[model samples]
Target: MFRVQKLLVFEFEAIYEPVLVEGPVVLVDAQGNGLRQYHMALTSRNVVFSCDNLFKNSTRRGPSDEPSWEGRGQDPEIECLELVSLVPLECLRFNFYRRGDRCLMMLSAHQAHQHLNVKEPMIFEFGGHNFKHHFWYTWRERVASIRVVQPRYSEITGSSPFSSSDVQLEEELTVQVQVHPRPIRSSSGIFVRCYSSSGEGY
Candidate 1:
């Protein structure tokens, strides 16, 4: 008879990367589709949306040291960080919702602020169900610090300043927005490493 030795099982829970929670959160549409592989950062001061392939494979620097959007020949592996949109903290609204099995955080323009370029609310999905409370609380604290209003759906459909008719007028009055791609050396905020058995994380 062979004696069996004791087996030690170490268990752990799944969690999101510290970067995903803190600095760059993947942006998704209303239906949960990724928005051109873009990411957004919501800090206490302002909101910044950027498009990059930092999580992808290539790394080639474009001319002028910034990522070039001028051609597709650019290295796909190059982590090109392109500025998509930037909105001030005071010019936004925040809302949270639980749908099906997912939690969503919505960012929209503040009713009183009309100069923003966001024609619609930007939605970000929280994939960490287990960490939803932590996630919500973290964001709530940041958002609550500012006097932000919850967006109203009716305002989108009703007579609002962002109405279709006003879009042209708004665009005509505002300066043309330009997108520039730059190398993102490091995202803002502290980053802590999270371990996963599968070598992957949200």
Candidate 2:
């Protein structure tokens, strides 16, 4: 029984490790209808996304640890895109969006990993507020949270998933998202994984 418990624990750890979804984060409008989605996979130096297959209907919890060689995974046809403009050793700024009772999040700019195309920069936004600690610290901290959110624009109500509406941004909510890697940092803390950038997260 003890050995069986140990085995079960190992399997549980494998299945529900500390990680976000490798699946699309589904998003519905305020009325809750057929909505859009965004698949985000963050790394230490880069935040990647699968651009080939957007607006999927699936909503998975945690990422799968199964080896892809076995021919089973979510969005196998997904085309990976690297927002190759992040330096995990710098400060990442944050912005909050709120309208009365409705609150949202949008994060922009990085102090360290700034490699974005000047013409088209990607803004990371979340659907809600209250989780500022997830991104409000240096990357070298003992643990950091990587959150995935579906952006709901105020003007657009169940329109194109990627519609560019007039953005009403608010005051800056700053967060120290990166720092110099320390020698004594624990290996068991938060780790990120994305295509081409594997191993413990930044």
Which candidate tops TM-score?
1
Query: For model 2, what is the alpha-carbon lDDT of residue 162?
Result: 25
Residue lDDT tens for model 2, 55-135: 233344446532232333433343122222222312233333333443332333343333432222223333313542232
The global C-alpha lDDT for each of the candidates, from Candidate 1 onward, is 0.41, 0.29
The collision pairs in model 2 are 86-113, 87-113, 137-176, 139-177, 139-178, 192-201
For candidate 1, the 10 contiguous residues with the lowest summed lDDT are 1-10
- Model 1 residue 15 CA deviation in Å: 31
Model 1 / residue 90 / CA error / Å: 1.4
Best by lDDT: 1
Error of 1 at 113 (Å): 3.1
State model 1's lDDT.
0.41
The per-residue C-alpha lDDT of model 2 at residue 16 equals 19
